[model samples]
Target: MLRELEKAEQKWGGSNKLIDQWLENRRKLLVHYCQIAGLPPYTNAEKSLPSFEHVKSFCDLLVDYVSEGHFEVYDQVINACEKFGAPCKAAIQQVLPKITPTTNAALDFNDKYAETQDDQVLYQLDKDLSELAHTMETRFELEDKLLEVLHSKYSEHAQQA
Candidate 1:
């Protein structure tokens, strides 16, 4: 499967500047994630454990991404939806609640892991980070659904202010 982010880029990448920038930020997040997880171009032939610095750095990036979603993306999309009327409002009502858990989890993950050194308790931290990443992956899907709602119906009019 091509995955939500990649699929989203192809479908809505440049419909507007906000979507374009958001998707690009998402791409960078994923690549950094894969690097921390030792999963690809960041690696090559050998998988490596994430450094404590890498873990903290990724956590910071994750927090910034979440903040941007709430403070920037949500504000822009909801306002656009409002301007578009009922179906848009209905779609947001249906989707926003579902995204709350993901948002909370990302925040929780930051509080729980951001300052901790992964090497202090390597095994446990690795397991917990794995779970965190999985949650992040799922969260991205829910977010993409929210964005799709706006892009699918009102991209032409959703240009940022």
Candidate 2:
């Protein structure tokens, strides 16, 4: 996931300030996730549950990232597409619907872990995180596709204008 994010940053880093910020947010979220999941450099040799503070912090980021994508990023992209005409509309239509399921999954993960006091919920954290990771991977791919379609069409329009 980290490697994929790095590639995305290289490809789309400065294409637009909004996208740059969004990708940076993704980088932070992924790093936090890795630490919590005990992957690689942040690995927990003891395999203990992550600190409650860490989990809460991650959940906060999770919700913020998701909200920004839905309310800010997607809206801007769609508005841009409309302003530039319909060249990318079909691709956007296709990608947006696919993104909804991922959003629901992410929100579900946030709800499950964001403010829990039960150890049983904590016990399920590993499995839930694994599932959320998969969902996030899918979401990122769809978002990239949307961005690619929008950027290509918008760039063409800009050049022609």
Query: How close is each model in CA RMSD to the real structure?
Result: 3.6, 1.2
Per-residue lDDT tens digits of candidate 1, residues 31-75?
777777666556645545577787788888888888888889888
Clashes of each: 0, 0
Candidate 2 lDDT, 1-161, residue by residue in tens: 88888988998889889999999999999999998999989989999999888998999998889898999999989988887666577678889999999999988988888888778889999899999999999999999998888878867988998
Cα lDDT, model 1, residue 156: 54
lDDT of each: 0.76, 0.89
Q: After superposition, how far is residue 56 of candidate 1 from its true place, in Å?
A: 1.3
The TM-scores of all predictions, comma-separated, are 0.84, 0.95
* Deviation from native of the Cα of residue 86 in model 1, angstroms: 1.6
Candidate number achieving the greatest TM-score relative to the actual structure: 2
